[model samples]
Target: MHIIKYLRSLQIRPNFVKKISLIQARHLQTDVFETTKVKYKYPPVYDPYGPRPPPSEKVTQLADQIMALTAEERAQIGSALREVLKHPKLEKISTEGLDLSGPAAGDAAQAEEKKEEKTAFDVKLEKFDAAAKIKVIKEVRALTNLGLKEAKDLVEKAPAILKQGVTKEEAAVIIEKIKAAGGTAAME
Candidate 1:
């Protein structure tokens, strides 16, 4: 009989009132504490339980000394450090691998191989003195083996090749002969 009366008393106290009390407790727990002080310090990443490495005393002293330097001194030191980092020690590079190898090696060699072997040179008549134009024309005509009209046209053109593809020695000889003929010719 006493247990039945206690159960009846609990039912009358109400379920809604219990729910409100639980919500109020949760709200108080999540409430922001505006009066609490903020800190900037961070915890070290190293193991706190193990032995710590000795602090760098020299580094700290050096840092303090650096801090004591004037702005100009610091700037100079900074520029020096920058130069050291940015520019490495100069060393001689192989000149052979640079520009001197010419068209006889590597990519240039492949290109040369693809090209027909240079047996004869193409003589480019660049310019000739007006006084020696007729002489230059006759020289071009003799070198080219073209007909009279064709030779005349080629000479009138002013810029014409006297030969096709030749060796270096032959090309040099041709250029020298053309120079001797009072015409500016290049062996290509």
Candidate 2:
């Protein structure tokens, strides 16, 4: 090959020339043999349980005592504990002119709004009188977009949820209709 003659003229040793020719051949071929190294940024893991000591016996004993209390008593204790756990420095710091409602407060307000908005309700038909079964079926059929056979089957399956994710007003209207039909219904 012309490459060998060129390498010989340059006085590159035979073995080095062979290596050079092989590398050239590799470059001439498809780029399948070439690879690129990539550096990646991996996020640090948060392991709260790692490198933590076990709770002391006294703490465990107190936990057991708290567990033994009634649910209402435990709730009261929990509220008291939360109050106790509040940073004491917060009480010492006087904010007479500073605005308390900052971005963090806005986030808290949004969370409260999310909790207050109960937009969805599930309407459940608890029971129906044998005499009012037909009326209940009709009411259910009207409330739901189900056919007569499906509505009848739904009515027969007492204590079943008629509809889910309905608005509060719609659920109330459905409940009222079912009640008027002599079927006990509730919204959950």
Candidate 3:
């Protein structure tokens, strides 16, 4: 049984009544306590990506005027628009019909494939012989158009990149020059 029931059954006297009332008050507070979920509210906002409203009367009239144009006139307008918007993505917009589907997903895939084919190379300098350090410095200076001190510092830092974004033929020629100068180099 509850402690309050037990206390009441004991019938202790007026002296314990105050302590009994305090305990009952605490018990009553715990019993009356309830859990409730709190919901948060925010001000209304306009979402641009949501469904668009209908066109105005002026826009409808413009559309009707454009649609009433001759095929030749429409072709001329289409060519003029294509000239104005000279982008590969915009090329897919058809002037023959109202093609609202926009560019296909394959365009991004094709661009990724083209990017994967490496066309540029970086020339990296490996370690060089101590005796031919001057010649290596001169070679680096000639290749990078750097000052004498800058070139020497670069040569000191072995396994460093000398030049970037060079074509395959140019990279081969650079490697040959470095080899002749007694310094090892490779294309990255």
Candidate 4:
């Protein structure tokens, strides 16, 4: 028919085509247009400059200095640096003109001092012999149902009760108390 031919020949705008395709696709689950597959080719790379310098000037200077140094001199300098690193003294800088002392400074100093104080358990752990410490760790693990590492950590952290003088039975009681407190303990 002439009307049908005229309608087919008429150019439908892209927006109208898109709207109709979207509605048709949603209802029929069919895409209106077939996608075209495209393969891309990379553009050729260009090098503007020639090869760079062999070594940077700073690196070359460092290499030269190293080459110039005698082995003995290097060793002496290394030892001196190690000594300085091991024990560094803080030089007191006078802040008389500056008001640096405040609540934050006092709080920081207090925190540091508290960190330095040794706990009772820490002192006891320090006194434990290697064997006693091992036993304590094992016992703590058994009593608390904790892993080997955790038990060992506990024993190592509290060595006073893990000392050679302390009996296995006494250690068991301690482990029992820890278990009762909802913690793991080993007392074998």
Every candidate's lDDT: 0.73, 0.87, 0.86, 0.57
Model 1 error, position 131 (Å): 0.7
Of 1 and 3, which scores higher on lDDT? 3
Q: In angstroms, how far off is 26's CA in candidate 2? A: 49
Error of 1 at 177 (Å): 2.0
Error of 1 at 85 (Å): 76
**Rank list by TM-score:** 3, 2, 1, 4
- Candidate 4 displacement at residue 77 in angstroms: 98
Best model number under TM-score: 3
lDDT per residue for candidate 2 within 94-121, as digits (tens), equals 8896657655855887766656568899
- What candidate 4 gets wrong by more than 4 Å, as runs, is 1-127, 159-172, 175-188
TM-score of each: 0.36, 0.40, 0.43, 0.20
Per-residue C-alpha lDDT of model 3 across residues 124-162, encoded as one tens digit per residue: 998899999999999999999999999999999898999
lDDT of 1 at 63: 91
When summed lDDT is taken over every stretch of 10 residues in candidate 3, the lowest stretch is 87-96
Candidate 3 deviation (Cα RMSD): 17.7
The TM-score measured for candidate 2 stands at 0.40
Off by over 4 Å in 1: 1-120
